[model samples]
Target: MSLVMQENLEGKAEIPRIINDGKESVEDIISNRKQISEKQDELEEVDRELRDISNELKSYDLPEDVDVSSLESQRSEIEGRISEMRQEIGRVEHEIETLDEKVDEIDEKWREEAAKESKHRTMMRKLDFVEDAHEELTEIKQTILAQIRENTEENMNRYFNDLIWKDEDYTVELGEDYTVSVYGRHGDNKIGSLSAGEKQVLALSFMSALTKISGFNAPIVIDTPLGRISSKPKKRIAQNLPDYLMDTQITFLMTDEEYTDEVRAHLQNSVANEYLLDYSNEVTEVKGR
Candidate 1:
């Protein structure tokens, strides 16, 4: 599998290797990491055993009547045992610390891998969406083209009716531009040639048409929806938005000016829910597992 990178170079695709060593590599790393963790746990067990032995040694009140040398020898044996236990405990703790560091490193690597996987998944999902859109466009190719033709004609008549133009034809081109290319009667130019404001109108019109046709009754989340429009065009959008998004679920993410009280009041009639995120004074708690 390949990680999805937005900056896909000219030669970036990796050839599918017949013999995959990735699984083996992953197994090795996982095995090593697991071994370290297990060893650390075992070390903790040994430390507890040593502590118990030390406590037992202290609990035994040696008899005063016993031979001094014999008592010394017995105490020495216990001391030796305690010493060995302490050494073992130290060794286990060192190994545990080492394993802890190694586990941390493993986690860091997994984090990087997860991020790459997420990006790859996101890229694949996007491709799937585009392919679906393309398929949808393919299925309704003629219908959408006709709609575009009709809508474009209406917009041109309303906006550029008095302007001098060239080709006066607005025939819908089927599958030619994926329903995006608009051959203006002014010069038969593509929609790409349209002015900024015109492009905004076209985009809004296209979105309205798309959502209306798709029939997905979901909230519309708009981030800076009016970034590309002027006051006049924004007002026009405010007035004309209802024509397209009549009863459809919609959400608009906006800033102060974009979500002004007037704008909110205007959209409130169209939208049933609204929220404002003000981080001026907020607090959050963080904890670790």
Candidate 2:
């Protein structure tokens, strides 16, 4: 997999492939995230007020030492304060309801605007939107996301199986927070537990699947394609990768470990041009392989 695909699987903190190559700049999407954050701040303020009211109501508890009948005047004062607090609480509760309604309205508008912009609505969703729409928009967003994830997973799994030359079965699930979970014979496999070579394979598979599904015919360039894998897998990859890519052009940046004699022999017929970089004390030179 490529760095871009790895970034997508890791989290949205790193930029992923831009599904919309339209005139919209990165600033536009970032602005959307910022707007969502500001709206969230507003909601938090309303929540704090509601919490304060609730705390005030709880504070009206009478002390165990106090006698209600003996302190009749004090009891009346307490009653009056309790009544006033209840009314204020009701008012604050109403504000919370109103704020929630407004947030829902804005969320709907944002979804509509994203659709109109021809951007991927799934990609446009922010964490605040997910939390705010917990009851209302969760189902709607899940339905859309499920469909896209299913297609992407199917493509990704197929490509991974073929490229990795593995006989076993595994599943790929695209999760929330831009996480990619791999399920193998053990039920669930953590990406962190995988070796560097395995990570590379997974990333390549995902990138290939994304490109295929997106209907993009652009050439692919992979840096350090087989840097970490053991000998057996490297041989298999070198032999199979060109065929897997088919007509799509692929460029690989490789060190001596990756572009070994075995790899060169496997790619003998497919090779169009090759180069060797020679580095010395001051300068470097590129020579034909």
Candidate 3:
């Protein structure tokens, strides 16, 4: 039974392929990641604000002397507006989370079928009539599995190394589960774990790496990445981001406090565009200044 399963898996799986066009420009890669992260963050802020507005309508109360009917009508209108915003926000958020899932699906199908073709390459090498197709199938599956493992390892390592944890870059595990295990630095380990900030960075970093390695084009986006960090680290992030992520276009969505002039100057040369979003009566608008 195990052999049969292995045969089927190999017969339907795909082999590994890596880029040979030379290493990608680190600058372009990081810039793209930043663009995507910023856009996603913008949508998230809008979604949260809409939720708060919806809750405000639900909690509205008027004085006894006020026109109850008119007040109720106003509240209802606000509620309807929030509902509309929620629908739009939901759609946008879904697209962000699944960003390149469709691409993955398409590539996965191709890889599975390519595994079968690889066997033909081997069979042609051997002059013997390959009647034992199962032998070939098993080999293909192993090859495909090995490829997947290698890709995941490389993808996890690059970003995990950038983590600011005290531990020596060992908290990351990309073998079985997409889980990050933070361990103590060369001492007694108290259950390994990734902090919220570390996990966020790892996820963002992996997303960027996967897109680049998979040969798919995507704009990098990072929203409120410093939400978990202090002003000091945030400043450090602003100063060195472009150095690590050179040419990648990035969009950084941030609060005013997080987007101070000092921070802006640090990233000015790296940032292609800067935007300002301000709240207005019954409407919020995007402005580029």
Candidate 4:
């Protein structure tokens, strides 16, 4: 086999080999059997005619007034017919024997084919088992994902509530697709309509909730933290984010304007391993703070 076909086979489950090639097809075998049957029927008809001729000869009676010459002529003609009928019977019997031999050969092939068919059925059953297992695994995976989403949704709303100080009536919705939306007292507040500060806050809350529920331990990193938001929302996020992500390590990439003295004070006790990036001679150096 080619390397590709071999690799494919290695990745797949074992199945029965097909044994249908290099032999007459089932349809052809059936046609041969039908012909044999037809010939046998013809043979039977010929035998019946032979028996009828014998019966006619035995049951024949001549009138006492009939001439002797006429009787002999009639007997000769009857004998001639009987001879011809016997010859036909012999030919038909020989034909039937030849047909029977062919039928036997075809029957043996059928028996061998039945064995292959049995293997094919077994393989089909194995395939059905694999299909059933896949379906069950898919259902289990969906169930787990649904439960994770539910927990994520709960966590998202909780974090959103803590971060969003002004919008107490707003609720966070986490879709199965992991898209986050905020619902206000009036209706759904579109993410596109939110101010930059609000978007940052929402993103922080959503990520915190997702990380908390995902069951994977990883560090949280945010680039340009609170860079786009106004002063009020910036301070709010700076105060809340550290507490929300207390369980995981967080790294912040920020500009001087974004990381104010007040925000630093808010994170003083929780902060660890702070660094500054200093550019000199077309290269940046990491400086410990």
* Most accurate candidate by lDDT: 4
Q: What is the lDDT of residue 196 in candidate 4?
A: 73
TM-score of each: 0.37, 0.46, 0.44, 0.63
- Cα lDDT for residue 236, model 3? 60
- How does candidate 1 score on lDDT? 0.57
Clashing pairs for model 4 are: none
- Residue-wise lDDT of candidate 2 within 177-270, one digit each (tens)? 5477777888877566777887888898788767766666788889998987887888887876776666677778899888889998998888
Following a full C-alpha superposition, what root-mean-square deviation does model 4 have from the true structure? 10.1
**Model 1 per-residue lDDT tens digits across residues 1-289:** 3434442321122211201234444455566556656755665665676566557657877577746576456556656665665666566556656656665665665566555656666787897899899988897987877676565545444333222123354432324454555665564756566667666566666566556656676666656776665554465566567656777666665667666556656665566555556554475333221
lDDT of 1 at 83: 67
State residue 265's C-alpha deviation in candidate 2, in Å.
Answer: 2.4
Each model's C-alpha lDDT? 0.57, 0.67, 0.59, 0.71
* Per-residue lDDT value at 108 in model 3: 60
Model 3, runs deviating above 4 Å: 1-148, 163-171, 187-193, 239-247
By TM-score, the better pick of 2 and 3 is 2
Q: Rank the candidates by lDDT, best first.
A: 4, 2, 3, 1
Candidate 4's displacement at residue 47, Å, is 18
Error of 1 at 50 (Å): 99
